[model samples]
Target: MPVLLLALIVFLSDQISKLLVRQWLQPNQSVPVLNNIFHLTYINNPGAAFGIFAYQTPLFIILTLAVIGIIIIAYKQFPIHNRLNLKLALALQLGGALGNLLDRIRFGYVVDFLDFRVWPVFNLADVAIVLGVGLIIWELWRKEEKGEAQ
Candidate 1:
């Protein structure tokens, strides 16, 4: 899928979910989805994922914008016409970036709600970003391995 389309979907879905959480739950409230395993917890994160770099909204905002710009430029210029996987990975990264960026711009924080008791709370954007980056890394590693074998 086109990176922009994926980005729009992630951004809208993240924003809508955050809105729903804000409407139906108070900050710090927890609703168990899978007792002891998962919970829908509403929390405002003023920093990067999992509360790291807490309260650095401005820095995160600028960094996200720069990342988005780089993604767009790189995608258009790269010769990956047959590499659907890479394109999808890039799209996912863009989507996740835009999702969190929107949150930072609108509320000065990213709304996080997914809670796995032992882990820091996070949202879909975090999931997408992690998966996208992992995929990209894996792809690059595979390419290097193939080149070395050749």
Candidate 2:
């Protein structure tokens, strides 16, 4: 129940943020919240992260569907014990992937806005995906260390 709720929240937040950005900013127009540090710059990305493999909409859609399917299978296989963080991490990834998938289906691209001076411009969905992956890696490392110490 909690996992579903969290996933729903992430999905809704990502979609809403992207919609608002689309309405407020023109493509390639940027509004800086923190001068020279962060900005909201709208873009339609037709490829993977950092704009690599640009203009491959169909490939991205297929890949996103595959990833979502794998996440669902993995989530179902997780032991029903004290792994709330693991569940939440999967939820985040699932939600984020779905959000981007919808964009690809509807627009042939993903809507990205949040921008930092250094990294590639990305959206809320991308943020959730990265954070989810990071959490999973950290949890696995922690588990391995505990097992080693015992």
lDDT digits (tens) for residues 38-148 of candidate 1? 999999999775678988989998999999898888788887687777787787788888888888988899999999999999988888888878878888898898894
lDDT of 2 by residue, 4-24 (tens): 788889999999999999888
In model 2, which regions exceed 4 Å deviation?
A: 148-150
Model 2 residue pairs with clashes: none
RMSD in Å for model 1: 2.0
lDDT at 23, model 1: 99
Number of clashing residue pairs, candidate 1? 0
Kindly give the stretch of ten consecutive residues in candidate 1 with the minimal lDDT sum.
1-10
Alpha carbon lDDT of residue 117, candidate 2? 77
Deviation from native of the Cα of residue 146 in model 1, angstroms: 1.9
Best by TM-score: 2
| lDDT of every predicted structure (CA atoms) | 0.85, 0.89
